[model samples]
Every structure is written in C-alpha cells, then in structure tokens.
Target: MNMKEANKKAVEIILKGQPTLVGIGKALDVIPGMKEDIFLHAGPPITWERMSGPLKGAIIGGLIYEGKATNQAEAEKIAESNGIKFAPCHHHDTVGPMAGVVTPSMPVFIMENKTFGNKSYCTLNEGLGKVLRYGAFSDEVIDRLKWMEKTLAPVLKEGLKIYGGEMNIKNLIAQALLMGDEGHNRNKGGTSLFIREIAPSLIRSSFDRESVAKVIEFIHSNDHFFLNLTMPAAKCIIQAAEGIKGCSILTTMARNGTDFGIRVSSMPDKWFVGKAQDVDGLYFPGYSLKDANPDIGDSVITETAGFGGFAMAAAPAIVQFVGGTPKDAIRMTLEMYEICEGENDTFKIPALNFKGSPTGIDLAKIIETGILPSINTGIAHKDPGIGQVGAGLVKPPRNCFEEAFEEFVNSMEKELSNE
Candidate 1:
C-alpha cells in the first residue's frame, strides 16, 4: 500500500483501540518477556556503560528490590555484572514513567486492548519526589515499594475482581479529559475518577478496613497516581498500529535519560535516536536547568497516542505545574494538530468547542511541516538519588524524526524502483 493508505489504516486502528485495566500482577508473571534476571527500563535499550545516571540508579534499586544485592554498592556491581540483563519495557508490550525500571518483584498494572486483543503493562506510580521511577532508592523509597507490593497491589487486584473483571480505561480517560485531565503530567481529574470507579469495589473486597483506607488515602494523595494507568492504556492503543506495511506514522516516541527515540509503524524494529534534550519549564525553588536530567520516560506514549501534550488545550491549568499560560497550552495543542494525522475520537478538548484531540503523529507531516511534538513531563535530578526537581515541557530531538523520515523516503523509493 502507499503511505497515505497505510497511515490511514494505522491511525484507524489506534483510534479504535479500547484499553481496559484487567488487573494487576507481578512483573515476573504477567509482562510478556519478563524474567527473574531481566530488568525493563523506559525508551529504547542502552547498556550499563551508556546508561544515564537516573537509569543506572533505577537499575541498582531494582537489583536491591529483587534481593540480588544488599546495598547500593553491591547493587551497582550486580547491575553492570552482565548476570542482570536490561531491556526496554516497550519490547515486552509495556510502558512506564521516568527512569521506568520494572524489576521482577514489582507489581504492574495489566491493560488489555479489548479492540485488538493485545496487552500492555506498567508499574504503579510511586508518587512524586525521591521515588524509584526518578532513580531514588533510599530507605523510604524501598520501604514504600514494599508496602505497594504487600498491601496496595493485592487490594487493587481484588478490587478488579470485585469490579467484575475489568474497567474500561478509554471511557474513564474520555470522562477525565472533559473533567480537565490531559492524561499526562496533569492527571488529578483522572485519579479522582479512578478512585470513584474502584473505591466501591475496593471497599467491598475482603481486605480489612484499615488496609483499604490506606490504599484509598495513598491514591487520593497522589494526583499522578493515574499516570501509570494512562501510559499502558496509550501503549495498548498505539501498539495496535504496529506491523502495518508502508505506514509512516509514528508508533512510539520515548526517551531514556540518555537518548530520545522514535519508531515508525512500518519499521518498528529500527530505532531512530537522538541525544535526549533538556527540559524548559518551571523548577522547584532551589533547582534549575543544571540540576535537571535530559528528558526521560515512557510517559511520552501518551502524546504519541494523541492526548498528553496533544490535548494540552483541555487542561489549561497544567501551566501551574508545567510552567506556561493557558494560551501556551492551547498554542501547543494547535501546533500539534499540524503534525498529527487527525484528531482523537475518544479524547475531546472542551476548550475548542469539544474538538477531538489531535491524534496519531505522522512522520510525513513532521517532515512536511517541520513541527515537532511537545510533551509536558516531570523533571528528574541529573544525579541518581535527588528525585524530581520539577515539572516542565520538552520535545524530542529533531534528529530522531529527521533520520526516520530519511529512511522512510529511501524505503519508499526502493519500493517504487523495484515495482
């Protein structure tokens, strides 16, 4: 098929996807390629020698969390020892936030694309500041992770069973968008809705009252608690677009602290990478750009699927967190529309008279228009243990799309010559 026809087919599959949160399971059990010695991080793969500090730190924490090491020094040693293998979460049909490490023992949300019969997984959000996803592995971080494993996961798992097998995430996110969630950096609306939907089932579960109360409190306190859910849901939607021959639409846009990468729908295995860019936005009182790491996380999957940054106009309040005015938010959304194939059917932005969100990043459009996708994200400290320094806006390096577009043209020309 030609590029236009291929892109239309791919975008339709993405829009038609209905990702449901089926349940939660240990990383070793539910994630497709998970294994005891395997560690999954965000973005395209990188080795210990090339890994950024935050990515390396998360790997150390994962080793310690999995009992393969006793202390930081030991964990660091084991991580680079080759006995522990590192892979990207995307390789196994999963997604995660900053640093995005998934160890064997960690509990992860399981999302199934009810429309496509595919699945995606993500670890629970650890809240903000000095958490594992940001590469912090202090005593409190490890302790909190233990609590999530022991109490939180089970409660949510049982709650899902009580919720009659699954919860439709598309409907939930659609409602959340109307309620002021852009389904990315700002998810207060989605978290509140999530709690409302699952609380009844959680309360009705056999777990005792105090445990349920703590779980409720934990989720209530963290506005971004719903982020993990959205990441995998987006992944479930976008993964459906893969394997479509001649499609020039982008199936993935991700960053490991060291590299920004993109995958074309027709060439999913070929990663076009560029150096990760520094974020430009608001920081905590004492932190500045010098303290921030290059952009990182699987969270950009939200933008790739057409909601996060693409729907910024819907959440004008996001500026309070990511640093920009309401007009800036709307401007970003308008700019994104130029690079995408079309607007989303499920996620509508009320600020524009309930217009559908711009969805499906089209590589051809990026090449033709020279406009890039912008993402709002949490800022992590350059060093491993400092955690989140702030929140901000970022865009993937232009070289990534430039390289991918170059290949797309070359591939198409080769096909034409042969024909």
Candidate 2:
C-alpha cells in the first residue's frame, strides 16, 4: 500500500482500539517477557555506564527493592558489575512514568485491548515527590515502594476481581476530559472518576475495613492515580495500530531523562532518538531550572493516544501548575492539530466544543509543518534523592521527527522499488 493508504489503515486501527483495565499483578507475572535480573526502563535502550543521574538513581533503588543491595553504594556497584539487565519497557509491552523502572516484584496495571485481544502493562504511580520514578531512593522511597507492593497491589487486585470484568478505560478518559483531566500530568478528574467507579467493590471487598479505607485514602490522595491506567491504555491503543507498512503515524514517544525517543507505526521496533531536553516552566520554591532534570516519562503515551498535551484545551486549569496561561494551553492544542493525522473520535475535548482531540501524530505533517509535538511532563531533580523539582511543557527534539520522516521515506522508496 502507498503511504496514504497505510496511514488510513493505521488511523482506523488506532481509533477503533479499546483498552480496558484487566487487573493488577507483579511485573514478572503480568508483563510479557519480564524476567528475573531484567529491569524495564523508559525511552530507548541504554547501559548502566551511559545512564543519567536519575536513571542510575532509579536502578540503585530497584536493586535495593530486589534485595540485591543493602545500601546505595552497593546498589551502584551491583549495577556497574553487569549483574543487572536494562531494557526499555516498550520492548516488554510495559510502560513506566519518569525514570520508568520496573523491577520483577513491582506491581503493574494490566490493560487489555478488547478490540484486538492485545495486552499492555505499566507500573503503579507512586504519588509525586520522593518516588523512585524520579530517581529518589531514600528510606522513605523504599518504604513506600514496599507498601505499594504489599498493601496497595493486593487490595487493587481484589477490588478489580470483585468488580467483575475488565473496566472500560477509554470511557473513564472520555468522561475525565469533560471533568477537566487531560489524562496525563493533570489526572485529578480521572482519579476521582476512578474512585467513584471502584468504591463500591472496594467497600464490599473481603479485605478488612481499615485496609479498604487505606486503599481508598491512597487512591483519593494521589491525583495521579489515573496516570498508570492511562499509560497502559495508550499502549494498547497504539499497539493495535502497529505494523501498518508505510504508515507515518507515531506510536511511541518516551524519555529516560537522558534521551527522548519516538517510534512510527510502520517501523514499530525502531526508535528515532534525540537528546532529552530540559523543561521550561514553573519550579518548586527551592528549585530552579538548573536543578531540574530533563523531561522524562512514558506518560507521553497519553499524547500518543490523542489526549494529554493534545487535549490541553480541556484542562485549562492545568496551566496553574505547569506554568502557562489558559490561552497558551488552548494554543498548544490548536497547534498540535497541524501535526496530527486526525482527531480521535472517542477521546473528545469538552473545551473545544466536543471536538475530538488531535490524534495519530504523523511524521510527515511534523516534518512539513516544522512543529514538534508538545508534551506535558514532570521534571525530576538532576541529583538522586531530590525527587521532583517541577512540572512543565516540553517538545520532542526536532531531529527525532526529522529522522523518523527520513526513515519513513527510505522505507517507502525501498517498498516501491521491490514492487
């Protein structure tokens, strides 16, 4: 098929994909291809030697969590010793936010694409600051991680089971848009909606009253509770559109704090990478731009599925946190339309008068328009243990899109020649 036909086919699959939250489980048991000693990270692949501070910090945290080390120094030595294996979460049908480290025992949300019978996985969101995702691994961080695995994961698993079949994630995301959640950095609406849906089963669950209350409190307290759900949902949607030959639709956009990467539907496994850029926005009182780590996270999956940054018009209030005006949010959404192939029929933006959010990023459009996809992201601190310093907007490196477009052209030319 020609590029046009290929793109049409890709968009068709993307729009029709249905991702539902199936259950929660350990990474090794739930995520496909997850194995002992293998940790899935964010963005393109990189070794321990080349990893950035936050990435290294996360690996050190993972080592501690896995019982391989008792202290940060030992963890660092273990990582450098080649005893650990690092791979991108995308390679294992898993996605993680920020540092995006998924060790064997970490609990993950499993999403199933009911439309295509495919599954995707993402680790649970650990609130915001002092979390492993941002490369912080203090005693508090390790304790929180343990609590999530022991108490939170089991309760969610039981709650999901008691709730019966898979929960429709797309529906939650659509309703969330109306309630002012773009399904990424701002998921307060989505988190509330999720609690509303699961409260009934959680209340009646066999777990004791205190346990139920703790689980509910945890869910209610963390506004980003919906982010993990959204990531896997986006993964399922984009995975459905994978392998459409000659399609220029971008299926993946992620960062590991050091490098940013993108993958097109036609070249599903090949990553077009560029240096991860620092975010430009608001920072905490004690932190400045100098203290911030570069943009990081698999949360970009939300934009890949046509919401998040693309649906910013629906969440104008987000500007207060991310350092922008309401008009800037709307303008960003409007600008995104130029680089996308179509509007997502399912994920509508209420602020835009029920118009579908721009969906299916097309490399050709980006190259032609010279506009990069804007991302709403959390900024980790550059040093380990400092955690989140800020939240802001960032754009994928231009060279990433340019290189993807060039690769697409080469692939198309090769296909034509074979014909």
Each candidate: what lDDT?
0.91, 0.90
lDDT of 1 by residue, 1-419 (tens): 67789999988999999999998999999998788889999999899888888888788777877788878889887777797998999999989899999998999999999998999999999899989899898888889999999999999999999999899999989998998899999899999999999999999999999999999999999999999999999999999999787898899988899999999998989899999999998999899999999999999999999999899999987877898999999999999999988888889999999999999899989989989899999999888777899999998899889999999889878987898
Candidate 1 residue spans exceeding 4 A from truth:
none
Q: What 10-residue stretch in candidate 1 is worst by lDDT?
A: 74-83
123: Cα error in model 2, Å: 0.9
- lDDT, candidate 2, 129-157, per-residue tens: 88999999998999989999998888888
Provide the global lDDT of candidate 1 against the true structure. Answer: 0.91
For model 1, which pairs clash? Answer: none
Estimate the TM-score of every prediction.
Answer: 0.99, 0.99
* RMSD for each of the candidates: 0.9, 0.9
Clashes of 1: 0
